[model samples]
Target chain A: MQESVDLGPEQCTLLLGAGITGRVALSSPDGPHIVPVNYSVVGEAVIMRTSPYSVLGTYGRGSMLAFEVDWFDHERWRGWSVVVRGRANVVTDPLELDRIRTTWDPQPWAAGARNLYLRLHWSEISGRQIGVGWDPVETLPVRRAV
Target chain B: MQESVDLGPEQCTLLLGAGITGRVALSSPDGPHIVPVNYSVVGEAVIMRTSPYSVLGTYGRGSMLAFEVDWFDHERWRGWSVVVRGRANVVTDPLELDRIRTTWDPQPWAAGARNLYLRLHWSEISGRQIGVGWDPVETLPVRRAV
Candidate 1:
């Protein structure tokens, strides 16, 4: 039987930054809800855009949330996941907004006006891999673009 | 930009059941968390197992949670996600447990004594797709097991 390995902080950060999409969980009126968002990692924070009325925009700001990205190999039955625990906030700084656009704007695939720049700053980052010694993210089946 | 399509409940259930793994979100003491779990669909419930001390086992029972399964086609930049909102509970009934074991048993890859059988009964389900007519679940990049 294979054992799970704890990933280092640097590997966690690298894999988290390379993914264009991940799921973000937040508390909603009905219950706890999670949804995928296109995100760009800037420094110690993740930036994504959504409409002002979306579930994320409505309840995400000023709330502590979790963001996760994972990849699994079906043939080998191996997988790894990076989870980020942080507090979410709306991006309101003019300079930061300009820098976000200049650095790399997160372009959400949904067809709507994704005008709200939501940022989730990392307070804790951790990861684990079931298949040790294998570079899972770099060798993804589809090689998702960074 | 292509318009997003709203999928019916039946299509949502089919896609949700076809994926062997998904992210389950539960509210924890620190904040809301999301984690990947190997799951199987039975009747109106999603069944999986976890260690009794894990975040899911500790906080998931009797709590309202969200389970999501999705597949994205990077080449076309299109994707769809099915989200199910429900209350989770520990499976303690003998007949139901026997049925779960008889019917396809969910095998968690993680190495541990996963004694707690967690069942998330779906109270609501909804889905949306970016590419209107294409079957995203059937054409998954890696084709995750059902």
Candidate 2:
């Protein structure tokens, strides 16, 4: 963890929403298969769909994986990013899928809907935020208002 | 590509601007470093930045990497995602950095400025977008709008 790369509470608040998460897939010393997925954040975990035929299906489930979601506003010269380090596994419980389907919206844009939902339950959560004018004290006083 | 995945073109258009991009680092066998970054589309390439001492500085440069940027409007069930398969390396040359800096803004949010510009030169670029109401046909044409 570098001091220069610091993400504050304000930035972390933004990442809780349902955004497109970058799903990173690691090969077994073979090659690379990475995909962008639409996901919903549940508690400390990030969840998305999977295809049994895809590389993610092969490497991600029951494996250590990484998931990230970010937002940046250039005009304001400000941005925030969140990274979740965890193990990924396929969700098989019918009740879990039903609950997810009730609240979670899996917007698949590809040609196939395999409906293989995966969850990356975070073991370590770290983030950093960068902006032009971020006064810690100025923002600190506002925190008390909440 | 799965047929059940409904991706639309509007999602692609949104990802082209200064949106969120995730960098997946697979250096360590167990935990791959995933970081969210603010990025912009330069030609077909995805460009982003980080601090000099960031995790990306260690695992990112000269590595076979996967970069994905996406945005979703959950309320409308509309979103688009783009994934780039390429090698990521730090732009060392001052002229090259100058050119990238002109197009990409990698300023951090904390106190001091810590922006280390990098580019994911694409070897294979593919994207998918999905929208709710309209038929996937006219909204998400496969070809990139040049």
**Best-fitting candidate, scored by lDDT:** 1
Candidate 2, A143: how far from true, in Å? 21
Candidate 2 lDDT over B97-129, as tens digits, reads 776667655444445445666677777655665
Query: What does the i-RMS of model 1 come to?
Result: 1.7
TM-score of each: 0.95, 0.68
Residues forming the 10-long window of minimal summed lDDT in candidate 1 chain B: B137-146
Mark the regions of model 2 whose C-alpha exceeds 4 Å error after superposition. Answer: A1-33, A41-44, A93-111, A132-146, B1-26, B40-45, B101-116, B132-146
Q: Which stretches of candidate 1 lie over 4 Å from their true place?
A: A140-146, B140-146
Question: Taking the tens digit of each residue's C-alpha lDDT, what string does model 1 give over B39-125?
Answer: 888888999899999999999999999999887766687889999989999999999999888876888887889889999999999
Residue A126 displacement in candidate 2 (angstroms): 2.1
**Each prediction's number of clashing residue pairs:** 0, 25
Q: Roughly what TM-score does model 2 have, to 2 decimal places?
A: 0.68
lDDT per residue for candidate 2 within A80-110, as digits (tens), equals 5667778887888988777777766565655
- What are the per-residue Cα lDDT tens digits for candidate 1 across A65-118? 899988876667789999998999999999999988887898888789989999
Q: State what share of the real interface contacts each candidate retains.
A: 0.71, 0.46
